[model samples]
Target: MLIRLGYEIAIDCPQPMPVISLLDVHKDRQHDIKRQTKVLTSPFTACDVYEDSFGNSCRRYMAPQGGFQILYDALVEDSGEAEPCNPLAGETPVEALPPETIVFLLGSRYCETDHLSDLAWRLFGHVPPGWARVQAICDYVNNRLSFGYGYARATRTAAQAHEERVGVCRDFAHLAITLCRCMNIPARYVNGYLGDIGVPPDPAPMDFNAWFEAFLDGRWYTFDARHNVPRIGRVVVARGRDATDVPLLHSFGPHKLTTFKVWTYEQESYPVRPPARGIDRTLTTPLIG
Candidate 1:
């Protein structure tokens, strides 16, 4: 199936500011793109594109003072399959984990493995380790926290989200990732396009989604503590220790968001979308302008 994905975001700043954006699809999905518009901006500025440490495609450009806007549109092919479930994928012992996967087992900016280590054992020690344990964490998080756009907090950490028991999708990912790491599992944060492809349409305006991956049985497998069920049309753009590493946009200066909008759907279901919004504005450099 073909899916249309894009976003338009506008912000206001007091002065010109340098910003980096991770709006491009991940390199792994580059071959899946059927067509795309180069990331475009209002009041065009010079832009440099490069790969970040985690291999995520990144765009760097300076935003002019006042209102600035950035937009991207693309059509990508998908298998139209739901999230894969493999309860048989057993957890890898820490000593046997790949070097790269080791980083995911430690704490990061939003995921605090140290803070949640003891709690993780107390809550999950009895569960059979491996895929089932990961699913249990997802089940716990999905039921513990109330999800809503109003619960978003840019600075919230996994420990804080656990205590508050209220958060947006990122919080769910953070809390889940933290618990996985504490249990000696390699779990990393993921953010990307998740269209309402095989499910009913979401009435709320679309936004990039947050989830996580656990390295088990020699590979990283997708898991969403927020949804707690298999989902389809997940298009990954970046992965890292937490939201801090994969911020859709990071600005060097303060800015005020005046408008934001996002859209993702099967090509045939594309709507008449408004033209103001940006990708993952929930975590930044904030957004353009």
Candidate 2:
């Protein structure tokens, strides 16, 4: 299946500002792109692309005062398969886990392992270490919190989500990631375009989504605490210890978001199509802005 996806975000700044955006389709999925992802900026500025320490592609540029817009649209081919699952995938011992994967096991800005460690152990220590345990954690989070876009909080941590029992998708991911770390399973936060394909369509505006991946059987596996079901067409945008490491946009100066939009949907074959262009339809350089 072909997945058409992209976003348009506008920010207003009072002075020149440095900004980092992680909106590019992840490197792992770059090979599947049938149409190049393009990032167009209004009142354009030159942008340099580089991969971060965590391996996420980032765009750095200086934005001038006034309103600035970032836009991208592309079509990517997907296998139309749901996230893979292995019931018997076992967890690797900390001593045996890859050195690079160690950081994911520690606490991070949004995932507070120290605060939820006790509860995590008390709730899941008895369960076998592996996929099943991670599923249990997702089950707890899915039932514990009520999903609501209105309940979204940018600063809420996993412990807070557990106590509040209400939050958006990121809250669910943070809580699940924290619990996985507390259990000695290396898990990392993930954000991307997850569309309502092969399922009933959601009657809401499309937006970027967050989920997570836990290292199991020596590899990472995707898991979504919000839906608690394997999904298809997850075009990953970035991954890190927690949300802080992969914010969609970070500006050094004060700014106000004037516009935000996202899209992701499966396309029927033989009709070769491209995503509809934004109002400011001018395309930019390097194919990836």
Candidate 3:
């Protein structure tokens, strides 16, 4: 199957601002891309692309004072299969696990495993280990938190989210990742495009999506506490210990965000002519305080 996906974002700065973005297709998916446009910006800001420690492609550039915009679109090749469900995938012992995966088993900025450890143990101690245990965690989180855009708190931590019982997809991912770590499972945060395919269309505006991956059976497997069901067309952009590590945009100076938009869907075929760029267009708005 072919999937079309991309994002358009516009921001304004009073003066020059250095920023980094993780909006490009992940390096692992380079082979899966049929064709894509280069990351493009309005007013043409020079950019340098680099791979972060987590292996996510990072685009860096300086936004000139006034209005700055970014746009990127792509057609990706997918197998047309939902995420795999493996109930028999057993958890790897801490000592026997990969050295790199150990980082995910510890605490992080948003995923406070230390604070959630006792609760996780008390709630899932006897739920049977391995994939079943992770599913149990997802089920609990899916039922525990109320979903909505209003509950999206950038500073919200896993413990805080569990107490509030309200949050967006990142919170669901944070809580689930923390609980998994407390139970000695390596889990990491992921953000990317998840179009509403093979499901009812959503009336709300589209935006980038958040989910997570847990190390099980010597490999990482996808899981989503927010949806708690297998989903199709998951195009990953970045992975980190938590949202802190891979925020879509990290600006060194303050800036006003004027627009943010995203799109993804099943594409029957490619565009007649591939566009020569990337990022948000039609952002002629003047900068404001």
State candidate 2's TM-score: 0.94
How would you encode candidate 1's per-residue C-alpha lDDT over 134-182 as one tens digit per residue? 9999999999999999999999999999999999999999999999999
Scored by lDDT, model 1 comes in at 0.87
The root-mean-square deviation over C-alpha atoms between each candidate and the true structure, in angstroms, is: 5.2, 3.1, 3.9
TM-score each candidate.
0.92, 0.94, 0.95
Better of 2 and 3 by TM-score: 3
lDDT of each: 0.87, 0.89, 0.89
Q: What are the per-model numbers of colliding residue pairs? A: 7, 0, 6
Off by over 4 Å in 2: 270-289
> How would you encode candidate 2's per-residue C-alpha lDDT over 1-289 as one tens digit per residue?
9887788888999999999999999999999988754577888789999999999999998998999988887778999999898999999999999999999999999888899999999999999889899999999999999999999889999999999999999999999999999999999999999999888999989899999999999889999999999999999999999899999999998999988888788767523333344433533211221
User: What 10-residue stretch in candidate 3 is worst by lDDT?
Assistant: 280-289
**Per-residue lDDT of 83-103 in model 3, one digit per residue for the tens?**
999999999999999999999
RMSD of 2: 3.1
